[model samples]
Target: MRRLAVLGGVSIALVAAAACAVSEDVSSPPHEEPEQSIPDADVREVAVGSDAPAPTRGLLCSSDGWCETLLPDPDLVVRDIWPFSDRAFAIAESFTSGIKVLEWTSTDSTWRYIDDNSQNEALAELAVGIWAPSADEVYYAVSPGTIYRGTRPVAPATAWSWSSERLPDNNPANVNHGDATQRRLTLGVWGTGSDDVYAWYSNTIFHRKSEGGGAPAWVPELIADDFDAPDEHIFITGAAGKSPNDVWFAGSRRRGTKEPCDVLVRKTPEGYRRIADGVVPELYSDPCTAREGIPQVVGGPRAWPRKFQSLDGERFFALKSWNNFLRIEPDGDGYSVNIANVPKTLLDAPNLISLWGESEDRLWLGSTFFNSNRGVVVRGSQVWGDGGVYEYSSIALNGAPSNGPPNQIRGTSNTNLWAVGDRYALHKTTP
Candidate 1:
């Protein structure tokens, strides 16, 4: 059930290859000792990661080079994606047809089926996550909790402004682990619009605020009050920021020896701190805490951190434990992590699921290797002398023989990318 994917626009090609060096010594004197600012040439590139080699077969590509499989029923499985501004929204499944929510705007580039009420099968088996923040604000998340808020239709025979409520289970109890008990999973949804939204159940942190500006409500944000104890259990996997007080939330805290460290936090206006705790001890060792390796999965989130932030939230990243990428920054009164390097290591998989871009030199990475069912699509580059590094170059989009396992990836640039899993869906457009 590891499907997750998001936003849109186009034209993105940021390849920063800076090499500047200016020095003046006109004999020497102005204070006499000032000449040691040399730090360049580090074009960051150490990624043949997870051992990239064979690929280029029929060359699967989207973004116009033609890579189509938008469901003509190849057994359907394009779980999540939410591009904007030419519109896109996806969540599809098919065992005999069950979960569906599809759309493509700007007058249909192809892909339809969007009938609401979350297709109700008890809220499509407690929805889980899908966020859109624009193109008429969309959101859906249901579980032993809820939150639905659509608003599309402005034409094409208009009429869609649904809404549902109930969300505040403040850790509604679950976590025993002697014989097992941790099922409360619902772990995503970000914000920056629709009155600053946010949602995260399982380490609780809900908040919405549109106020005198009107409509947008969901509360339960008392962030980090000792973040749950009695043997630990914090879980918030991913969040971004721009407002709602400059945010950032990436998770992991499990302990009681069920092990699962690394949990970074940061939310301002003076609340919630702790930038790095376990900071990723290779994700608590033993190749993701022993037991045949990775998949400590209980109710939700056993996925090792997948993140990316920078839209005025001031840079932060974490592809951690699929073989490290952690970045963090802004150190002067707090924060500084850095641990890059993600290249070749598939069968040794440790989960590096999804991450998007718009910055960090046009980032985007998505991985999955459930023991060689394989999946990868890395293309990140952020190189600038000492203290500015991140370089990855991967391929092997599971579609080797033909498609599946990209999990989720979104784009608004970097050639307007988009990726899906299992039954396939791809679109890269150009560059």
Candidate 2:
């Protein structure tokens, strides 16, 4: 099933449901930075209506920006791509039904499923998220249910065995709250190693440490114990860290009679503590009044900053709805959060599906245009991969054909990127 869309974009239809709209003065700003260059050659006209030429549904392009179809059958919809090593492990759904795992082979330039119909069903199950610390060490979580770990020999060999464990039906986590398929009880899974796996379910986080057993035997532990009480109501969305102790979890809460707010929490050997609240503020605001407002959960599912990832050992990045980009870095014992200035065109887009980066300087953001199949790519860069200052520009997309913006993006480098979504699979091989 497709992962539920995170609420970061401002949809035209959701304007009425907005918490409160107060137009703020857009005159002065906190700090001014150099604006980045836009790749106008890559930007194309929005293909609209039935008369437009059919989009190249499964496209894979090179570093130079030349693209070609990756899948022979246009009916196969690529959902997610986990580019690990020289190979890419992805979840693709065929027209007939079922989300299957597809392994892209660099050797022969082809794609194949991990498990054919006759093999183990555990390998056949669709996963909500995929992560590969290494080619031999890969992990994926099937929402509302289990987490599977797959170890492989290398590419071209599609055969592999997996170890699966059922997620505990613990307290406070309501996996069965909404739609069982689209909105999985489990949001995502990640780890630095097999024994140190972490899974997020609703507002709770579960940890499975290697228990001296062979082949990654995992015993689940309710690691996130210090969540906000029932009064505030916490919802855990995105999580990532360099290690188990050096991790960060992004969540939001609506306190009694108070506005909803998002907070970033960091965990260490000492324990977890609230690092920052109202982390990403509106760009056009008084620095003094920036933290004065709250970020009410707008469109749906937990919202944007709900998703985050570490760009390197020192820096982390996140997104907030209605066009707020965040940059986080280690500052002594805590973290310093900076509100980034995304391209205005991208900020006005309707929906944001995914955010990922190959490095601190080469960041990618995916968003859907208002009422159009076209998605926008905002490639951002900082001053020499270090944080605190940056600039961004949008690359308009063509040939999406109403499938929605690209949902997930992953790459080994900027030139070796892949953006997969509802009905489209785009690849960038060259610079």
Best by lDDT: 1
Against the correct fold, how does model 2 do in TM-score?
Answer: 0.67
Name model 2 segments beyond 4 Å from true: 1-66, 116-127, 153-158, 173-186, 212-215, 221-233, 243-245, 254-260, 270-304, 345-347, 383-402
lDDT values for all models:
0.52, 0.51
Which TM-score value belongs to model 1? 0.29
In model 2, where is the ten-residue run with the lowest total lDDT? 40-49
- Each candidate's number of clashing pairs is 12, 7
lDDT of 1 by residue, 1-431 (tens): 12111001111111111112111112211121113211111112111111112333554543324254345355667656788757777766667655655666546345665544334534344334577777766776644455666666555545555565655434324443222012223355678777778887566667776557875676556433243345555567677777778787776666545446555566777665545443222324432322221212121223446654555687776565564454555544334444443444422563566666657655566665555556656655662123333433334343353353466777787666677777766776666
Q: How do the predictions measure up, each by TM-score?
A: 0.29, 0.67
The true-structure Cα RMSD of candidate 2 reads 14.9
lDDT, candidate 1, equals 0.52
The 10-residue segment of model 1 with minimum total lDDT is: 3-12
